[model samples]
Target: MNNSLQTMYIEMVEKALDRYVSTQRCNNDHVLEAMRYSVLGGGKRIRALLVLNFNRILGGAANDAMEFAAAIEMMHAYSLIHDDLPCMDDDDLRRGKPSCHVAFGEAVALLAGDALQTLAFETLARNTSLEPAQVLQAVRELAAAAGSRGMVGGQTVDIEGTAQTVEQLTGMCMMKTGALIKCAVRLGCLSVGADEASMAQADIYADAIGLAFQIRDDILDVIGSTEELGKPVGSDAEQQKATFATVLGTERAQSLAEKLTRTALDALKQLNVAEDDPLYEMTVELCSRKK
Candidate 1:
């Protein structure tokens, strides 16, 4: 996206997250605090931006999409919190700060993640602006993406160390990382009643960019700095995890990302979208992003 619109999205997503976190309540405030810390912690908020931008493309109101955008971010934060647990990635850092498990005790961190996951669906269900059918459709989409069929399934494969090839690893990445992303974009269309053709093109674009995103992430893990990445770099290699960079080599991984970017752009073009469409720019920026 152009600098101005990109900045606008960042600001809007951040504000929505802050507002949502502030509204959450519980008798034991500690878990809530941890949830806030995890959800409000710094990151790109790419999923949220995806929802917002796609909603914009479908002529949906930005304000109307904020809740869905924030919901996606909550789900993403939940996944990250669990992903960094001792039994998972075993990372101590996230977004330049202590991971939730490190900052809070593991029990509280675990509860925080659970809460966020549920809250995401709650946010979608409670959105009264959309038709009840639309909200239900969005909820189902998110549930499938976050559940065993998507992110959880991918994580299972990753933890089992079952992937042994570039294609296998890429498939895992699609489920683990790209599923939520695809859901995010699709949610925008569903919420706005975008036609089936629009949704079809969105699927094409989301699928391509989702894989491209993981490839770029693998590339960053190889070449990125700890400071710039806001987390430990080279963790994939340290853990001997199969990744695009490891399977295809760095140069080939980079080329694959570009190729996927081209595919995403082509899909977007087939929709007859404007030349200045934010999705186009965002896809380009995502392929080249360093952190």
Candidate 2:
């Protein structure tokens, strides 16, 4: 059942993402090509899936949440493109393909990231299925999550706090990697008019899983193969980037990831949702994922 659900979810997200890129129009072919390339670059689309799952949990239609999901994905993609720049991580590859800066020039890649970031807001604002108020709220949530107060701020700390202690490093990872994830779930709840209590419950789940997600990522960087991960293995070590493996050691990091997954599952219990719910199972599987 989990396999079926995962396959279905991946298919749905892929179709939505494909449509999103194809529908976009730009004056410059180069800019358009870069944007499409960056977005079409394959990924797990976990953030978008989180949005969809929470939207369902909150009683919103999946279709109603589709635009917002796509928007969030665009924002995520933009971040990755910028993160892989020569001035940033200087990654040459992503998802088994050349990095955006490698596929296109650095200037075009930068423009593509910028375009995708702006397009995220545009997509959210243009979501006709949602009320104006809901759309506006989602936009505001995304702005905070993606902007200086959230992911960007976290990234700044990550770069500056490289030599910091484990606690500081964890805090940076939480902000940089977890903020947008929290926003994804929160926006889904808001879309369905969930009460404060329900939103808070969702927040607990998001917070735990968000941190777990990053911890697993750090683990993957150490142990996962490039073929399985679709990116260079041990890139963090190669770049001397501080990670959970670097500070806490691999065994403890793995244990922490398991603990966080339990925390996320426990938070979901407050929802009174079904045990057999696909979202619940997906959340569990995500933390335990090998790749």
Candidate 2 colliding pairs: none
Tens-digit per-residue lDDT, 8-96, candidate 1: 98898888888877778888788999999999887887888888888887888887878899999999999999999999999999999
Cα-based TM-score, every candidate = 0.97, 0.94
Give me the displacement of residue 14 in model 1, in angstroms. Answer: 2.2
Name the 10 consecutive residues with the lowest summed lDDT in model 2: 1-10
lDDT per residue as tens, model 2, 139-181? 9999999988888989888667554677876688778889899
Clash count for candidate 1 is 2
Candidate 1 residue spans exceeding 4 A from truth? none
TM-score of 1: 0.97
The C-alpha lDDT values of all candidates are 0.90, 0.84
Q: What is the Å distance of residue 156 in model 2 from its true position?
A: 0.9
Candidate 2 global CA lDDT score: 0.84
